[model samples]
Target: MSVWDDLIGQEPLAHTLREAVAAARDRLSGGSGRGMTSAWLVTGPPGSGRSNAARAFAAALQCRDGGCGQCHDCHTALLGTHPNVTLVATDRLSIGVDSVRELVRSAALMPANGRWQVVVVEDADRLTEDSADALLKSLEEPSPRTVWMLCAPTAEDVLVTVRSRCRLLVLRTPSPPAITRMLVDRDGVPEVVAAFAARASQGHIGRARRLAHDEATRNRRREILRIPTSLIELGACMVAAANLHEVAQEEGQGVAATLDAKEVGDLEAIYGASARDGRARGYPGALSTLKKDQSKRRTRVVRDTIDGALIDLLSFYRDVLALQTGARTALVNDEVRADIDSLARRGSADSTLRRMEAVLKCREAIAANAAPLLALESMMLDLRV
Candidate 1:
């Protein structure tokens, strides 16, 4: 087995990265090679496995046998337990300068057990301007034994200067067949369920797996799909918007509940806060700051969930438009073929297109920090069929 094995339908990319790994190994042995580089920028569409590719590369760099997936080095690096590998993935909206500075400090250190100190930033596009500036110096003069791998949606999403300093690797979305095979063979999903998920998720591997395994996730998607049919009048639209918002809030709470408790517990432990001893001095202020951060995180999580639902809703409309136009393409929401056909029949192609535009506008509004309920209400009104 190899680290590249899980990277389905990306053979060309895998081959290129493998060559770079071999070249880096040769350079370590005092033999010059052309493919090796200290910094790499990996870009791809959402769920195209950019971070997976970065992690695989880091594992290959640390592995003596060049990413023999069974080895301890490969395991540790992939699992994020390697002493020489640092994987920085954020749940926050942006990567701050403080975080980048700490990573920069770590990057300056030499490897303890591996050939290179690998630093993988999973969301390079989320770097704030100050954080980007802080990252520039490290990219410009990286330690000889350090390798930086940054992942983002596209090259343009990253700062021009930072992108210019790294080798670029673009990964394509895996095909449905490839995703289906992975779901069945790797995740042990039933073939029929895997096939449906692979089709429905539209090349998003993580979402495909979730759709296959999680009944609640699939149910949420079904509810989103039903929105087009539900928006029959103003009252219905308002109710739909409220329902969508509520679903997103519930999912956001589900996602954050455990993490929030763990974070509170950790903070309490650090400050030695206990009911037996009462609150420690200065504990209130620190707890307040922590709560503020958690509030921001929860807001972001809710917004992200809403954004995903919007995407799914958009896909349904796109399917409607496709049907109206006589397009032969497979529908992303094939599970609701009858409903999509009914929707397409009820609305003209032009109206379907207009509804799609409303969805896009709502996404923009939410992204601009407009009130999500208001934006969703407006979108739902526009979507009234």
Candidate 2:
């Protein structure tokens, strides 16, 4: 295992990154009259490793051997300890104007390592309008040795002005076999567990890895996949909706709570002593910021959890669709084939497809800022009928 292998199911992306690195290196080595551009946009869906591609490219650019994978530059970049590389990863909802201003000021300086100064913004979508505008100016007139890397779900997530000035690299979801092979060969997971996780994650490499490694995650998924067969009555549908919302909340809270505490603790340490005498003028504002961040994180968690559950729910209907049509390809819920057979007998293929459509609508509603509880409840009611 080479370090790049951690980027599972992303061969095309890796190839593109490699090509970019080779070109950048060739330009940097004084072989071309054209100078290397100082900005790049790496865009992809969730869990598509846009940041990973950017980081790998960064490592390759700084590497003496052009990402030889064994050099100090490559190792440090991969481990996120490279001296000239600055990464702004927010646990909060947005990258505020203050932070953006500071990073912009930093971009003007020469590199401490006498190499390229690299700035990677992981959640470019979270940049506030003011921050985005600030970043736009920096990108428009970059310093000689500076490189700006922004990662987001799509190019449209960043301002068109910012995106138009940079090179763009788009990433795609990997195949299930590619993901499974990675889990088994690289992570040392068993083939059976790897296969299950691969199918369950629907091509998300990180989620699949977690599913393979964590029993609790596996159990949660099992609970979700079991909901379809259990929704046999009106009351049962209501109960299932409530259950799904609660579980998603619980899981999201579990992921966010510890980080939230850490952030609050750090904030207190920065502004505590002065506030004790009622002289900390900005204490209230700081507290508000903390609360807002927490709220946003909670919302993000709920959205992610619900999205995963929706996929799980969709798989059950998909299996039914496959069975009804007599297509013998592998089912997502292969372990529950018997239940699928039973459901197929009760529902027509058209009904199954309609349920899938309802699930997709629920996803759109949640994405468009509908309340999670209401959305889930409505989806459940529709599914029950």
Top model number, lDDT: 1
Q: What TM-score would every model get versus the actual structure?
A: 0.96, 0.90
Candidate 2, residue 3: lDDT: 49
User: How well is each residue in 1-385 modelled by candidate 2, as lDDT tens digits?
Assistant: 3446656667776776667666677766666624366888888887777777778777877887767778888888877789888888887777899999999998888987766888999998888888888888789889877889999899998877778877887888877898889888878999999999898787788888889999988888888878778877888888988988998889778877778888767877888787545577887788777888788888888888899889889988998899999997889888888988888999898989989999999999998889988999888888874
* TM-score of model 1 (CA atoms): 0.96
Pairs in clash, predicted candidate 1: none
lDDT, each prediction: 0.90, 0.83
Clash statistics: count for each candidate: 0, 0
lDDT of 1 by residue, 212-277 (tens): 999998998898899899888899999999998998788778867878888878877887736225
What C-alpha lDDT does candidate 2 achieve relative to the native structure?
0.83
> What are the runs in model 2 whose C-alpha is more than 4 Å off?
33-35, 272-281
